[model samples]
Target chain A: MSNEHTAGPHSVGRRLIDLVPHIVLIVGVLIFAFPIYVTLIGSTWDAATIGRGSLPMTPGGEAWTNYSQAWSESHGERASYTPVRLMLMNSLIMALSIAVGKIAISILSAYAVAFFRFPLRMVFFWMIFITLMLPVEVRIIPTYKVVADLGMIDSYAGLAIPLIASATATLLFRQFFLTIPDELVEAAKIDGAGPLRFFFDILLPLSKTNIAALFVILFIYGWNQYLWPLLVTNSADMETIVIGITKMIGTGEAANDWNLIMATTVMAMLPPVAVVVFMQRWFIKGLVDSEK
Target chain B: MQRRVIFDNKLLPYLLLAPQVAVTLIFFIWPASQAVWQSVHIQDAFGLRSEFVWFENFTAILSDPNYVGTLRITAVFSLSVAVLSMAVALLLAALADAKIKGAAVYKTLLIWPYALAPAVAAVLWMFIFNPEIGSLGRLLNAMGYNWDYRLNGDQALTMVILAASWKQVSYNFIFFLAGLQAIPRSVLEAANIDGAGPVRRFWTITFPLLSPTTFFLLVVDMVYAFCETFGTIHALTHGGPGKATETLIFRVYQDGVVNNDLGASSAQSVLLMVILIVLTTIQFRFVERKVHYS
Candidate 1:
């Protein structure tokens, strides 16, 4: 360990010192994952077992029964809306639309801001970026009025339109675009390529990484949104998964069903957790790039 | 041709700004103006034919006794959540930055809560806090501790704060990690060469370098604490255990969503917005200048 004291980036034994923190990190991950692990385990249990918090990893009864109960409550003693299919579809619709639409607009807008020598270029750029300050919380009431007035509430358009144009996306693209050499644009100009042509031809190919990164972030955000959807959608048909899960546990007095509620909550969480694990590389890269 | 040329450049600028301006006007500008308009005029939001009764609602809000308590509770809740979340986030960021092996796994797992729709986080916390079968309850019971958030005001405040801070830590951690990594690696290596001990290096070099990130985080965290905690508040406590966990945004939600008192809610909303704007301006103007980018 002392052999490379004066050397540059030394040996194998020294690397273990760097790894000391990682051992702690593994424990930290377990602590963080405890709630999620509990959610999954609890969901698998029947009502009687879940309340005890003594449910084993594998339940005695059918595993698919909880899944079915969480998905369709009518099959059980109660014949009513459990918010299974309707909310799932609504959330997916809202999230997918936001992802595709925001990314679509971001690509064009970011591409325009990056490749062109347009007038008010910097001013226009900042104008879009400043929307970051307009927290949705601040604007929720008024935005609701606008959505209502537009006759868009409870519809897919209301859920998606206001969020499609993202300041963060534009800023990220502008930052990435800064790294591209101007010589390429100049050469494209000499090759009789218009600004549009230059963007589609020269710039688009170079931005695959950025596009991938942006989609993952925007997708997660769109998927996880709760408040705006809850506010806009009044119809049981239009409720999101999160809202459905909340409604399932309505008021403490009505004999709150722990089994169905936990089961549904787990179902609501699966896709986003999968997104976090799978898209993490792109997620971290996207964040790091924006910081730069 | 010359006459057409005059307006062309000017028109292009507006054309570029048109979509953004349109959406802003539709969503933000109009809503803000409506918020202000509703503040002064007294009217039923859900009912027909709202009449303009100037200053009526504002006076009603100020005089309301419960509102006074609500405001005090809100100020305390939001401020505490901000400070506590920032502190916890800074610690997590430091731990994550220690270049630990599975820190990425920790980072991802910790941040998963942030992605759980605030609504779901609220529901999840409520289940965990359930006295009979909640994990926290069972754990506390096992330890011979009687932790009842429903009957205890102080405990309710503590419980809500813990939940809010838990959700918020990841929000701040991401920013802090970015800020910590932004501190040039070469400079830190230089400090190491000078024989700076771990504690000394952290206090003298790392903390100072991370200040900009910390400051940026403070502002962002404060805003999140103020505005974004509403869904959690609504789901978990509903300003319960005798108004112990009520916050500004929670109060607004109570007024608008529950009481359906549009007028009072609008006034509270306006006041909240004013405080945030003033804080944001000070943050950008004064606090931002003190940060050393290098």
Candidate 2:
């Protein structure tokens, strides 16, 4: 432990030595960025050209053709039902519903855990935590069976209802609520504010950073949902964007055109990436907080 | 406080918890239990009906060569992805902590890959590995190595691992970076004063301190790599070229969904759940002790 406290350094040499690792990390970043670049570049090339891997640095003049072809086949497989548009709409609805329901419910649950003295508080918290350990894949089939039995398969509710309680979200809000200054809640109570009023006006407003982070994280989690949606939706009508992309790639039945797949992949990747890029620190912070 | 007593009573708590509890129990717990019940029995090849063959499905799965291979591949895949992703993430996180100019931009670029859904990421990677038109294959062909991803099981597995690792690295990096930032500057300066080299500082000081974060990420990423690589398996390889990429989750999917052998699928799922629980419990037991919050 004492050895870890070294502060002596030759400034320039130290900086230069440190620069070596940073430079290497930049190379790592490039490796990380390669797929994004390849997908974007592939999207611009025609299926024929991109398939041949003959794309030039600049466009060889086939962007419009591929884009239009992609759009046409993609507009709808059935009656104005392109995988792209339909799945995009599905994604928005599913993601929003999950986010809204999850955040709202988790907030309430977290409040109970944080503020109220319920019987077996630790046990309840641990129960929620243990549920987080339950793998989604393990239950996906039985869940499918349940949904099928209920006649909810291929419906929006099928996708949204099953995942209504996000254990991770509840955990996050619970963690956040734990940190709120107790004095404020007391002050609200003294001012004759009801618990609900204090929760809304006093507690929530003070937890903006946490709520913002939670919103972004939950939204991304919802938007990126694939397995449940894939298992739930069969008709082209019910597919989410990610699931649509999955089906559009046409698993063993039809051979896929790599260029078109890449193009669609690029289009599908942008929205979540946009969200992540904007709120990166908060997202990372959220992960760190949860890790604790 | 008396006004709060009514609000805080049993009724309100249950109401607040009702929606989530009901959904989880119905969708997750019920289905999982159903699968467990089904697995003990046997089903027809086409899953039309089940014969009550006690422990037969479990016996068959245990004895099956394919099941063993799936478990091995899954273990290797999950371990490699978790360890490699954590290493890469920590390295990048350390660099970003060096306070280089444009550190924010660098961090943004590094973590962007994680935001892509697994299906999309797998697809994007497939383009790079595509023998016909993928950029990597093209670049490699231009450079003169054969580099066929679909040509062999090893190559195919490698491609999936890389893709999985790529998605995970950003997620690991986010935690690693945050952990790094949380380490106070004063301590790091003190380490420098004691003339510790960077590597020494990292291993002896920084890493031990990041143990809690590392432990947490270890469990999270392991669970993710084990259970959630199904989409990656589906879109990219489809467990093809003789089922090299058939992870436990994907295998369970094939048995339960496409094959519709509800009994056999359920058995596989139960086994998978058992494996997850055991591994997770062991991990928490071993790692939790070493994790120092302060």
Candidate 3:
């Protein structure tokens, strides 16, 4: 860690070298932040201002007007008109249900895989593991057929349930459960604690952090779901914010209301971005842990 | 990896496993098997009847020039997005890994883009590059450059690629930054004391040490480019001025959902599944091989 040799003659050069990293990082931050910044700024301006091709570098006085228009008004000339308010609620329901449902099922399944010695245990584990290879995009049509067959279309069940079965969350929970000391289980056995009691009393309490981390990750994953919701939910009321935003701009680009569209885009991004930014530590942990 | 002391209750274990098993079967296994079944059987145009035609659907899709073109387009698009995003991310990560002031602030700003949905990312860039109203698009036009993606095939592909890469850079950065920080400071310091310049040290020492992370990210980034960019393409170009931007995955959607060609779409889905499984297997094998190396 010593930099003693740079004290005398080369201090200027060392200072410049130090500045280089900062320069690069600052540029990087700006490059990544530029489009988001532009959108935020554009969302504040009037439709005419944006339509005239004048990019606002600063916030305009029409911020509320733009946001309220996006939120409350029926958007587009399309027949399937749903307010952004309905979409946000639908998105919330979908994201929350998927996150909660995934954690519930995944934790139980992980408990079985980690703590139990049932027959065909390896087979069950591999069955769940194989789901990781087949994303929603691959078998989307047939999956749509399955959901349709169950008459789940246009409901929260259709929007959330199919997505709730996550291989990553189960794997994460399994890894976490495996790290629990054997003494805990032994102690529970000695106390005549049943499996459910031990799980609820001890295991759940110990997994608070893991649960939070997975919640943040899965909430965002569910929120950002576009194709599946777009496929499954045809009714306007069932539209998610992300899907709704795309629908808003799904028409000819020349006729799009850039201001309202940008405003909706901003709204669509807020929850997920907030989850990631506010819960940065857990989000990072969840990402790294899930990938591992 | 099972525990020595385990729960022996027969009914309880099955009860614990039931929900996930049911879901995996109904949603995943069932759908995947249907895709395979449909791939071998083509329904008539009117949807009145269907007959088994083993390998006919696959052979038809394999021989179709448009399908072949889509495969090429996917290769180009995936490779471009991966390389562009990975290069930008590696550069940023290397710089940010230095012990610099406000590094945390910079990192926070950079990583939030990862949270943006692909559709949102596409719209944000689409607005910036919209020919009529986009600031950058207008500026480019004013500069006398013909930069309309709406009419031009190559321009649309380039726009989608940029949007996709922009969204991916943040994710790659997080992993690369973590990898860079995990390298031993002593090894780097030793190189410094030996009169090696930063660039030389980076090439000779830092990069090689970071290969595992780099390799891991390569597979993840490629997979991301392959499947997840659907929103990006769907929102922005919708596969285009003339199908120039339609990836294999997009064709699967277009053919199935839009065109209602169930047989061809199922065949495409099966092909995509094979590609992903092969990619995943390679990734796992590489990971296993790396473990033995260290």
**DockQ each:** 0.35, 0.51, 0.81
Docking class of 2: medium
Better of 2 and 3 by lDDT: 3
TM-score of each: 0.85, 0.89, 0.96
| Candidate 3: residue pairs that collide | none
Candidate 2 C-alpha error for residue B210, in Å:
2.7
Clashes of each: 1, 17, 0
- lDDT tens string, model 3, A1-292? 4556757436887788788888888888888788889999988987678878887799998788878877888553332346788899999999999999999999999999999998899999999989989998999999999999999999999999888788889988998998898998999999999899999999999999999999998898888888899899988888899888877776545556777887888888898999999999999888887887
Identify the runs in model 1 with alpha carbons over 4 angstroms from their true place: A1-27, A52-62, A72-79, A110-130, A252-254, A288-292, B1-18, B44-65, B99-108, B141-144, B185-196, B279-294
Winner on lDDT (1 vs 2) = 2
For residues A167-271, what per-residue lDDT tens digits would candidate 2 score against the true structure?
Answer: 777877776776666666677667888767877887677767777777777777888887888888878777787877766666422234545555566667777
Best by DockQ: 3
lDDT tens readout by residue for model 1, B12-69: 3355446655665577667777888888777655567677888788788889888888
Q: What's the lDDT for residue A51 in model 1?
A: 59
Question: What's the distance in Å from true for residue A180, model 1?
Answer: 3.8
DockQ of 3: 0.81
Q: Give the top-scoring candidate (TM-score).
A: 3
lDDT for residue A82 in candidate 3, whole number 0-100: 69
RMSD of each: 4.8, 4.3, 2.0
